[model samples]
Target: MKLIIISGRSGSGKSTALQALEDVGFYCIDNLPAPLLPDLVNQILRDPDHPNKLAVSIDARNQHSNLKQFPDIYKRLRETRRLDCEVIYLDSSETTLLQRYSATRRKHPLSDDSQGLQQAISYEKQLLEPVSDLAAIRIDTTRLSLYELRDSIKLRVARRQEQELSLQFESFGYKHGIPLDVDFTFDVRCLPNPYWVPELRGYTGQEQPVIEFLEQQPEVQQMLADITGFLEKWLPLFEKNNRSYITVGIGCTGGQHRSVFLSERLAGHFRATMDNVQIRHRELN
Candidate 1:
């Protein structure tokens, strides 16, 4: 069975992700006990009409003692032959999480009589580190609207069926912090600065003007060629090692101009060569 374990902080949109997976025909479960995962897998395996796809959410409500055993359980599930397991970890900034809780007036799973919302958020992040560390895909939902988050869940999780490598390209600005979840990151800060031009400053890299400016730069082409060539040569090695996903990050001074241009271009090049290539602009989104 193809299994997807969706886990994250309380307000990071785990419920939304589970719903999206269900919409796409995954037999989805939420807040499953940490230890019961293997039993569930075994049950699915023993069934005559085996389920083709399964998704489960490991919530923060799980006992602290049980949470500590997650590492061993996650490792065992991954090693199981019949279980094609992929971990999707969702996260958001503390400020955003706080805002979400305040707006919705929802109590955090870890929050109680003694703990405040902020403390609970911090404590939950610490608590969830074991599963988060094993995550094949870490999605930072700090900027995503509910609609966009659902779309991302459908696009990323639903697309990877079984033993398939999903490739993603993310563009970010150096001004913002680097993305925590990526296999490779290429900083194209040396590329032509389209933001310097008054006409193109207002436009983003997806627009024709910014694209044209970056395309005209010889060094930008070289950087793209080198990065693409290296990935083309090494990607098969990762596949051989049983890797399921690879994220290529491209960054510039600002995500709006050069980095975004390169990301779109690189994704365009690889889309012809592979089935599951995706691109995300961190600053723009």
Candidate 2:
């Protein structure tokens, strides 16, 4: 059986995630008593008619009293059955969580009625830390829009089924700086400034005029040539290391022109040869 334990700090969108799982055909139960999880799993393992995908939510409602028993239960479950268990811990910033709770007008499960929301948030974070650490996947939902979260979950499910290497590119402006989380970064700031050219000032590299001008430059040609060869040589090593997603960032002085062009060109080139590729320009607009 495929068992997934979904837990998070009180207002981290666990309920929303559970709903998404249910929509995807998972047999999901929310706010399940932690102590019942072990027995539930055992019974399902013993039963031939049980659903293949089972998801359970555990949170502040029943977690504090039963939290201490989790480690042992995890160990016992792992030892007894041929089961694939995954823990998904959802997390969001305290401010975001507080807003979510206030917006919903729901009392915090751990709150002392008069306790400030921040204090309750702190307490829940501490309480959920252990199980969160044990989770195979941790999702930080602070900055994710609902659509983004839904798409992220869909990406995870698709990747699980395909087991293919995923490649992502985030193009950025040098003025805004390179994306902090990029695995690979390229500086196109040294190339000719398209911002200086009045014709290309408002137009993006995706346009034919920008492409034509960029193609006319020798430096642009040489850089893409070298970068492509370098990526082809090293991409296999990343795959061998079992990387799920590789993010490459291309940056230019303003991010409006050169980096945008190169990023698009590189994405097209890589997609033509590689298994999976996604590209985004952070300042293309």
Q: Which runs in model 2 stand beyond 4 Å of their true positions?
A: 162-285
Per-prediction TM-score = 0.94, 0.68
Return the top candidate by TM-score: 1
Alpha-carbon local distance difference test for all models? 0.88, 0.76
What is residue 27's positional error in candidate 2, in angstroms? 0.7
Best prediction by lDDT: 1
Q: After TM-score superposition, what is the CA distance of residue 201 in candidate 1 from its true location, in Å?
A: 2.1
Model 2: how far is 199 from its true place, Å? 5.5
The TM-score of candidate 1 is: 0.94
Give the alpha carbon lDDT tens digit for every residue of 103-161 in model 1: 99988878889999999999999999988988888888887888888888787779765
- lDDT for position 98 in model 1: 99
